[model samples]
Target chain A: MKDALAHTHARIQPYVHNTPVLTSHLLDELAGATLYFKCENFQRMGAFKMRGAVNAIMQLSVEEQQSGVVTHSSGNFAQALALAARSLGVAAYIVMPSNAPRVKKEAVLAYGGQVVECAPTLTAREQAAQQIVEERGATFIHPSNDLNVILGQGTAATELLAVQPALDYIFTPVGGGGLVAGTILAAQYFGRNCRVVAGEPATMNDAYRSWQSGTIEGNDAGDTIADGLKTQLGDINFPIIQQGIDAIILVSEDEIVAAMRLIWERMKIVVEASSAVALAALLKEKTRYAGKRIGIILSGGNVDLSKLPF
Target chain B: MKDALAHTHARIQPYVHNTPVLTSHLLDELAGATLYFKCENFQRMGAFKMRGAVNAIMQLSVEEQQSGVVTHSSGNFAQALALAARSLGVAAYIVMPSNAPRVKKEAVLAYGGQVVECAPTLTAREQAAQQIVEERGATFIHPSNDLNVILGQGTAATELLAVQPALDYIFTPVGGGGLVAGTILAAQYFGRNCRVVAGEPATMNDAYRSWQSGTIEGNDAGDTIADGLKTQLGDINFPIIQQGIDAIILVSEDEIVAAMRLIWERMKIVVEASSAVALAALLKEKTRYAGKRIGIILSGGNVDLSKLPF
Candidate 1:
């Protein structure tokens, strides 16, 4: 898996941007750690998921490529898959809940995704995606629960290490776990003694609890502003996470909002709440990582301006 | 004046960021033009005014530098001067209106500017600044009217034209006239047949009227979200803008907010209302420059998230 990181990166290089690494003196001073922010928010569809989305779609056979890809997500991954599949000249069928924001649907549609609206339920979305797969012979790509997607997400960390080779730690927010799993893979194979840590909402800490229990865990409370991290971890990314991830740092809602505000005001970048979790986790234990070079993967910058916490 | 642009840019290079030039496929399609955005919003202190602040402070003699610098501004220039003077190891006295937001004052103080509070009136702010200059032997640096400041602001356009030569037009917002004047200077001196255009609020159209009447004009409407562009042109920059600037495109408040939102949502970057004025101006005349290369300077990204118009 480690050996194939570079190959996967190369395959997606043409379709994804080599997003810039950004830093801020104010954020560093406030957090008490030197932070190198991997700005995946500037990715093609405004998130690092683009890398995984493109990589997964590219790994398909000629017949599979023509059959196209399908995903059951209304988040960043939906837009990422749509754009990625379109870039590869393949059709994408995005199974989105009818209750999803008009903006999200329009974004998926704008990216050439064939939006298949379903009832506002996971079963409905899954059923719609399954129908597409059965009828059109389309391959279903799990947003963050697939090995190929994890491999693709690792490239962001790989690119980060290439620029700033000797980071003390790489931090990412734990959602369905592709980004963290990918980050851990990068740290294990490519980093210079670099460890991988993750941030999770305290209210939705399935990944953290799973790490503590040495097995898969689930949290039913989906009451977090970080709309992306509510989903429980998948079995595929869990074994890899349990093996290599250093720790899962949990942050409060206030902490999350504060960190997001700092990134917005101090760094002057638009980042969604989920993206700020990694920074929140770092700042939570700034004493532990004081003065050390840390790489924080800013997951995405998709936010509703009207609902800003500040 | 044209040749001086490079020297000013080189001098301020150490203090300010060589901000990235960004382009958006979505924005390009919306405007029907090839937009090269010089992201000065990413500059030190989160604005392009940092360039002018550093340049103006750097122009002082050893005696003047030792005596320190003073400015009356509650805007981005206050933070810019504070950081710039501090970077140069000089004391900065920023006389902001007492009624100004505490956040703005704290930003200046955080950047090492000595805050001198005065009544919320132009006369009081100026008097307080003049008193500081007389008593402390401090050199007063106007935010946008100064020649050195204009020269420094032009460096953004210089850097833009360097990376993206053969631009047909460079669009900038006319505030106190430093940015546009500097842009015109860069166009005349360094660009390859490039013409400089400006954007102004329809209500605060003093700069536009000044260009048309062949003399300096004053407008006191001041009814616009572009707080930075409410001021009229200065004597020093007026001549330069009159001679070289191609046109001043006026846009409504709704247009300004729409353009700003587009940059935020599409480009995934935070930009202030004044920065959006340039984009609004370009979009207003999108058909005129259809499919042509146009450079735009996003002046800053220091918007108050709480008061966002969207």
Candidate 2:
């Protein structure tokens, strides 16, 4: 999987920015570790999801390109797929939950995506996406679940270790499990002996439960400020994650808020609540990775200041 | 000045992180121009002032180093000087205006500087600093006036252009003009024909007036949320700025606040009001550099979130 991801990196090189890495002295002291932050917040469409979306789009058959691609997401993936489709000169249709952030929908539309609003329920979103695929004959790019997307997203960790080869641990926020699986694959390929840990919100602890049970677990999806982490792990994503991921840690909403503010104040980086989930795990000192070289994936920076969680 | 700054860069390289340059697709679209943001917000003391302070402290003679250094600043320079001195194993005495933000004062103290709280008036701050210099045999490191300090500050622009040579224009928030002068010197050395513009708050338009008159102008201490830019330019800094700087543009307080929020929201980088001054200028759509490659010096990210400007 990691070798495939390294191959995908070459395929997606022209499409994505080699987003710069940043470090902070104050954050280092506070965290009690040397931290190299891979800033994916600077990625096209303002998140790392573009890597996977573009990778998946690029691999489709010429006939598939003619038919266009579709995805169901109200967050980063929707914008990623829309912008990737635009870049590839292909059509993109996105089915978004009606209750999704207005900013997310506007971004997708601004990027030339044909948006279809569905009910907030997952079933409705899936059904709407299916209908769009059936009617338009477009290929659906699952936000997670799919192997191509997961491998594509894992290149972030691959690139990190390429730059800072001595990294000891990689902390990432886990939601649908694609990001974690990708990270794990990269670490294994590099033979870095790097611990792969997931920072998840206590409100949405399906990933944590799934890791413990060795099977996909669905919990009551409670509301969290980290809206991106609300989804449960998929069947395909679950198995790879179970094999590769080392641990899952849960942080409370307040911890996420504090970590977000801490990054804003001390690290001087604007990270979304979902991105802050990893920082929250570090700040909570949930599982000690102190004195190690910690690499944090700052997932995205598309936050609404007008309605900040804190 | 450029040669002197090059010396500073060599001297200070060991202490400071060559802070990463961050780019934003969202910011580019909003400004209708490409932006390369040299993120000094990630510097040692969370600002570019560390570059200047470290160079100045390191260049001190043995006797002066043993005697320590003194300065009066109510902003980022205070913590920068403190941190630089501590890193160099030299003592720092910071005379801060009593009305300075509590967080700023605490940062100075936390960095191992002895803080002397004086009247908020400039005269009182100077008097307190002089008294300390006489009593403690400490050398005064002027915030912007000293040749060594300005030369040290110039290294920031030199480093920036080294990383981004194609910048067509460089925008920097003006306080006492040391940082801008340094940038101008660097641009000249790098064969960059880019205009060097200063971002100043409308309420504190002394720099703007000075640029127009071709002479230093004084303004009554004006209240601005960008507390760092409230001071007038210095004697040594004024001449260099007059000869080299392209223009000084004014940004309204509302624009400053808006830019600050926009940076936090869109760029996912936390910047102080002073740092946002350049962004505010861009938001105002100042002519002469439209559709050009603009490099903005995000001076620092030291805002106290407890009392957010908004």
**Candidate number with greatest lDDT:** 1
| TM-score of each prediction | 0.98, 0.94
Instruction: State the C-alpha lDDT per candidate.
Output: 0.92, 0.86
Q: Report the lDDT tens digits of candidate 1 across residue range A54-139.
A: 99999999999999999999899999999999999999999999999999999999889999999999899999999999999999
Q: Best candidate per DockQ, number?
A: 1
Per-model TM-score of chain B: 0.98, 0.95
Which pairs clash in the backbone of model 2?
A270-B268
Q: What DockQ does every candidate get?
A: 0.79, 0.67
Name the runs in model 1 displaced over 4 angstroms: none
Model 1 chain A, poorest ten-residue lDDT window? A214-223
Candidate 2's error at B37, in angstroms?
A: 2.5
Candidate 2 DockQ, CA atoms: 0.67
